[model samples]
Target: MKLDIQHETHYEYSAPLRYSTQSLRLTPQPSAHQTVLRWALQVPGKLFAQRDGYGNEAHTWTLARRLWRGAIHAAGLVETHASPWLVDAPALPSPLLYLRPTALTPFDRQLLNIGAQALDGAPAERNLLALARLVRERVAYRHGVTDVMTSAVDALDIGAGVCQDQAHVFIAACRARGVPARYVSGYFYAPDSPALASHAWADVCIDIPGRLWLSVDVTHGCVMDDRHVRLAVGPDYAACLPIRGVRHGGGEEAMRVSVQIRPAAP
Candidate 1:
């Protein structure tokens, strides 16, 4: 499967900001599942800029008056050539490592305990698979109910959430069990489904030697594939993003986003 993608983020400020800086992790990676054919970004405002060797654009927006916007558009979308081998990612050169606790918060620790209890005597992969299946079966897909900051416990208690919520729940559980985990944001190119174009998921570092990091999309209840176009990868959403900046202004700010995806013929 192949697709064309468009993603845009805009900010409108009530007052001009003095200055701000941000880090971006928006560039996609070439994994066993998919490869980046073409990608680019556009900033429609005054800002400073820098670039990594990989050409992932990182810009700093400064001296804004009323509004600022950053946009990204991509095309030539493709799916993973073959199904990801969950237990045998070692066959692939670039493998993910399991996460270890680093400055975990009290809440994070507690969540790990719960995850362990929930999947007693089960491997991390099996636990993740079961939990993901359970969540999708129990929770109906709905928007406007939660955001990035919402915790996994919160979503589970409420019995409702979107993809991000599911990913958070999965991450929280994995972290509870001393496994390293991260969040992923990208486009989900569902060939026949038309519910949503964008999607989010989580990855965990299992005990598997030389093949620790494996991605699982809890929302879709399947391993990530070529259709999964990655934008960022980190312990959480806060760490992984294409561009994140703040302006020192006094008033409220409005934001707008525009994303487009054109899929190739199957």
Candidate 2:
């Protein structure tokens, strides 16, 4: 399937910013399941491109002048192929690196118990799928109940959060069970669910030696397929944020994001 995607992010600041620098992980790389036909980024700054530690294409955007408002636009055309739930790719950074807990994916006794209960004596894939389902069940999907700063344990306690929270919980549970899992930030083409266009998921390393991964959409209780477009992977959302920045000023900042994904003309 071919998809045309457009993402727009606008920020308004109460005060002018003296200087600003942003890290962008909005570009997707060509992989076994997807091919990037055309992609571009538009921002009011000097942009430099480089590969991040996770082997993901990253860009650094810098604005030296003072500004009170700014906008970022990313447009692309990608072709995705249908494949099994498993993601087969070379492990650039060892999968073991994902086992370490991050601020967003910290595991406690609750998470350990959840993992033990869900993955009891099941096959690798089955156990991971069960874990995903259990996470979804524990954390109901609801907006406005959580924010980007919410951790997996906090979201689990709140019992409601968006895809990001669900993915974090799933990652925490997987790592608690001695399974290596990483967070994936991407786009999901779901016409019925417009808000889900900007999506997050978890990728579990099912076969460490073979470097095989199972990409599970914990929010949807299923594995990733052609409908998903990969962006970047890291220990947590903070590591692979679509856009993160720091500014000298820009007090009381407000941000708005819009994402659209559609089938492209043949």
TM-scores of the candidates in the order shown: 0.74, 0.95
**Number of the top-ranking candidate, with lDDT as the measure:** 2
**Could you give candidate 2's per-residue lDDT for residues 196-229 as a string of tens digits?**
9999998888777777787888888778888999
Q: Each candidate's lDDT (Cα)? A: 0.60, 0.89
Model 2 CA deviation exceeding 4 Å by range: 84-91, 121-123
What's the TM for model 1?
A: 0.74
Q: List the residue pairs that clash in candidate 2.
A: none
- Residue-level lDDT for 139 in candidate 2: 94
Clashes per prediction?
11, 0
Please give the range of 10 consecutive residues that has the lowest summed lDDT in model 2: 82-91
Tens digits of per-residue lDDT, candidate 1, 105-142, equal 11465466556654665355666777677666545578
